[model samples]
Target: MLTERWRETLVDTYGTPPIGLVSGQGATLTDEKGNSYIDLLAGIAVNALGYGNEHVAQAVYHQAQNLVHTSNLFATQPVLDAGAKLIERVGDVNARVFFCNSGAEANEAAFKLARLTGRRRILAAKHGFHGRTMGSLALTGQPDKQNAFRPLPGGVEFYPFGDADYLRQLVELNPEDTAAIIFEPIQGETGVIPAPDGFMQKVNDLCEEYGILLIVDEVQTGVGRTGTFFAHEIEGVRPDVITMAKGLGAGVPIGATITRGRARDLFTPGTHGTTFGGNPVACAAANVVLDTVDAEFLAEVTRKGDYLRQKLENLPNVDHVRGRGLMLGVVLNAPVAKQAVRGGLEKGLILNAPKENVLRLTPPLIISQHELDTALNTLRTILEELA
Candidate 1:
């Protein structure tokens, strides 16, 4: 059904959808043909409180009725309130917020901020994906994506991920030339690989020794996806800049660059801005999302993550499991991830395979135990058949 409609209307970007979803409520989606599915991807980790949540919907409605947009020239109450709440939630008084429309845009703003500090070279990790924008693309270490868009902004170097010694050597060799070191706490696109033990701390020390800004791109892992408000909190390292988007405003399009200490003042009045960056509707939705992902909700996320890991580990053909909190990866014995995803969809489950051998799971933070158990059952049946 999706193929017939998508072939005529939509572009050929994503190929074909497994099913035509009509509506969603909580962690489940309903198709046009009356089929229901357990949504484990959560719109690529964008739905913080799941679909059609009362608080988020109400916040969007009230803000829409009140004030929607006033441009960046004038200050609005909702934007200011959201910014204050972000600072408070992060527990960093010196941090400042720069709003944007998407994860790539947030990374673009952070890249500009790093450049403004009089540093030229940017150091990123291998297989790390920042964004598709020109500035952010330069920092993306994947060659397959970057080769097509040649003549991109240069002066970026890629180092082995989770290798502190190689990173230290690079920083020491180019201390004065390096501007910032940007990386993801967990490499989501590359199968949810977290930093090795003590590697993040070593990277932080290297950045300090080289006087380079450290930027953590938390677009996919932030906002309770990793059982924390911010994933970097688990490592106990405060980055100079943190870029977030996916789960910030639930389903609304919103992104932000939060800078700490002196890095917060890098941008002046005319340096960087966006027309709809801090719009009232998006900020209002983000405020609701933040309020919903409090201490108790985070505890539930940890509990669910542990349960999901144990269940997935016991499933047939699942060789290993990686990642923390609700963000997890099931490494299969063979490259049957695509087949498993297709099979799960047929069994009324929505999942994603970011890599050939790794199946990614980013269920909504509000997903109930019953819902998770249902998903687990569906996945187990599918994997058994595929194997």
Candidate 2:
């Protein structure tokens, strides 16, 4: 009944609802039909603390009872606390935060910030996905998404991701008019592709050389997903603008664009705004997520990610694995990822295929070692059956 209702009421965008989840706790989910599955996707990495976390739930409950939203017209404690926490996490002395409601909005804010630099052109990495909105969509390099919506806010170009030489050439070619160079430290949707060695530093060098703003989209890789609070932290690169959303609020719906140095002053009053941005309840939830993801827990995430990757490397039909920390992509020898996903579901394990031959895994940060072992064993069984 829920599936039928979804088909009738919802747009035909996601094809179909795979299952109606009734409840979740930690790394596990239960469907309406009483089937339980180990959730490896974690709501596409937004469920950082996993489902039914008492701390997050309490935060949301208390905040909602007190205040949910006040728009940007008035100041609220939750929003202020959330912003301060974000600034603290960024560790940028001059950074200021703009809170929105999703990754797309965060990127949208970043795009507008770039435009304020008086340069029109924006360079992004090939196969990089920003969001589905118009501004962020224009910055996205995936042709399939852009082809339909032609004439989408021009002055955007694409360079090969992880190819520093190509990026240098492109930046050199459009030196004068290039406003910003936006990219994901690790491309998540096109499969988990991490930045090549020294590539991020090279990009930073080029951006500095050309006076172009460096915009790192950390929507999927931020907030302890990549073992660090931010993926670029590993590279020690200072970006002018950083967009983040997923895992920030631990599934409470929040987005943030952190701007530092001169970039922070680019937007003054009347330049930009949002109605539901920086919502109080969402900010309250985000504060808890930020407080919980400490240095020690992030270190454990790194260890677990290493363990999971090593286990997959020895699995059948897995050609290679890429990505950092818990964010991973399993590249298969054949185009059996969809089959593997189906088999995984049948075997009571939730997995996703972001690409035809690549399986993306972004389990909860609090996932146990036993759960990881179970997921690996289930994946091996699925791979053997597909092979």
Candidate 3:
């Protein structure tokens, strides 16, 4: 009934959601049919702390009671706190944070910053998904998504993802015309494709050599999802600009476009703004999330990620595991990823297929070993059956 109601009321953009989850706790979710499923996707990696998290709920509740929203004209304590924490985590003491509502807005801000550099050309990566907004959409290289919204914002060039040589050639060819190089540390929507070894470092070096700004789109791979505060941390590259969302608020919608060094000075008074970008309620929730997912907590996530990867790698039908930490994708020998999702749902497991043969797993950062093992066992069973 709820599904029918959704179909009639909501836009068809997302298609029909297969499961109508009524409630959840920790890593387990219960649907309207009263069937419980182990949630391995974590609302597509937004629920870093898992469901029914008391800490996040309490923070949001208290902040809502105190102050819900104030237009950007005024400052809120939670917003200031959230921004400071992010800036500290990124190790960019001078960097400033621009808050928005989702990953698209975060990337949009980064796009605008890139444009302000006075260059007409921008370089991105193929199969690298930024977001759906017009500015972000132009940076995205996936044709299927771009074709529908033809004639997107211009001045964007796409290179192959994880290919340093091609990227360098493109950047060199553009030279003075290029403003910035935007890329994801790990491509999530394109099936959790991680950058090739030293690719990010190369990007950083090239940007420096060419006087171009480097924008790392960490929207899906940041916030402890990749065993670090930011996925690009592993590359040891300090990008001029970084964008993040998803797990930032642990489910309370929040996005951040952070800038370091000269990039911070790009925005003039009337250059940019957002109304509900850093609402006090969302900021409070994000603060709790940031405080909870510290070094110790992230270390545990790394351990669990390694454990899950090892288990999946041993499965008969699994070809390989890609990506890092909790953001993983299983490339199967067969194009049964959709089937696996259906099987998982029927068997009380939550799974996702970002591609025809790729099963993505972006479990909550706070997911326990026991929960991960249980999900793995169910997945192993499903793979065996499919095989």
Q: All candidates' TM-scores? A: 0.98, 0.99, 0.99
Residue pairs with backbone atoms closer than 3 Å in model 2 (clashes): none
What is each predicted model's overall lDDT from 0 to 1? 0.90, 0.92, 0.91
Q: Give the TM-score of candidate 1.
A: 0.98
- How far residue 61's Cα lies from its native spot in candidate 2, in Å, is 0.4
Per residue, candidate 1 scores C-alpha lDDT tens digits across 1-387 of 766889899988788776787788989989989999999999999987898799999999998998889998889888888899889977888789998999999999988988898978888999999999998998898999999999888788999999899888888886898889888989999998998978888888888877889999999999989988898888788899999999999999999999886488999989988999999999999999877789998998999999999999999999999999999999999999999889988899988998989999998888888899999999999999988
Off by over 4 Å in 3: none
lDDT of 3 at 13: 90
Tell me the TM-score of model 2: 0.99
Give the Å shift of residue 149 in candidate 2.
1.1
Worst window of 10 by summed lDDT in candidate 2: 85-94
Worst 10 residues of 1 by lDDT: 13-22
After superposition, the stretches of candidate 1 with alpha carbons farther than 4 Å from their true spots are 1-3
Clashing pairs in 3: none
Query: In what order do the candidates fall by lDDT, top score first?
Result: 2, 3, 1
